[model samples]
Target: MILEFRTYRLKPGTSEDFLRVMAEDSVPLLEKAGLRVVDFGRSLVAEDGHEEAYLIRAFSSLEEHERQEREFYGSEAWLAGPREAIVSRIESYHTIAIETSEEAVEALGRR
Candidate 1:
């Protein structure tokens, strides 16, 4: 399996709003698109004086990840749905995917 870790640097004062939109709107869309949507929320600590958050998703392979992301991000459900609410809060973001054990992913999910 592959585990994707996404980190977001949110605009100042937008963490609460962003997290709400993500939980309410973003996560359902991701799950509907067949993505794992493991976990996501504002970071407990901040860096460089900006709000921070992270999201994790599990996929069977990198190819599945790419395809699913392309389809989901391009679909109207995302573009017309939470896209604005989700993207507008972010100052920047980055994503990294790594190969890992199912056991490791399960351990992460337990957190």
Candidate 2:
């Protein structure tokens, strides 16, 4: 599987609003497009009080990931609804070919 990790640096005091919109709207929309949201998180200690949040999306392969992105941006949800609400200013960082050792995967499974 391949994972896409997105980190959001949110305007201070808007973490709750961001989380609510994500849970109520964004997640469902992505799921509909076949992208699984593996995890979501927020920073506890903000740099100079600016909030940060992260989202991890999982796909079976790179091709699947690309296909999902196309569908997501082309969908009604992207054009007219939930996606419009949750996003403020977004800065995207990219990572490729993450390697997880077997021991780490086993340890995570135990959790």
Candidate 3:
């Protein structure tokens, strides 16, 4: 399996709004396209005034991840949803992809 860790450095004071939109709009859309939405949270450690939003999603393989990404991004649903609102509030973003074993996934208490 592969896990993707995504971090969004939100514009100051936008964390709560971003998280609310993600919970209401973003996650359901991604899950509909077959990505496993593992977790979402705020970072405890942050810059003096900047807040970060963290997300974890998993896939069976890189190929699967690519396929789902294409589907999600290409969908009209995504275009019409909270994507614009989500992107506009972000100051920066970063992502890390890691290969892992099923055992490791289970160890994290995730399927």
- Global lDDT scores for all candidate models: 0.91, 0.68, 0.86
| lDDT-sorted candidate list, best first | 1, 3, 2
Clashing pairs in 3: none
Model 2 per-residue lDDT tens digits across residues 41-68: 6767676666777777666677877888
Q: Model 1 Cα displacement at 40 (Å)? A: 0.6
Worst 10 residues of 1 by lDDT: 102-111
Model 3 CA deviation exceeding 4 Å by range: 107-111
For 1-111, candidate 3 gives per-residue lDDT tens digits of 998899999999899999998888898888886778888878888976689988888889999989988988888888988789899999999999999987776666442
Score every model by TM-score: 0.96, 0.76, 0.90
Candidate 1: lDDT over CA atoms?
A: 0.91
How are the candidates ranked when ordered by TM-score, highest leading? 1, 3, 2
What would the per-residue lDDT of candidate 1 be over residues 11-45, giving only the tens digit for each residue? Answer: 99999999999888899889888889888987888
Top TM-score model: 1
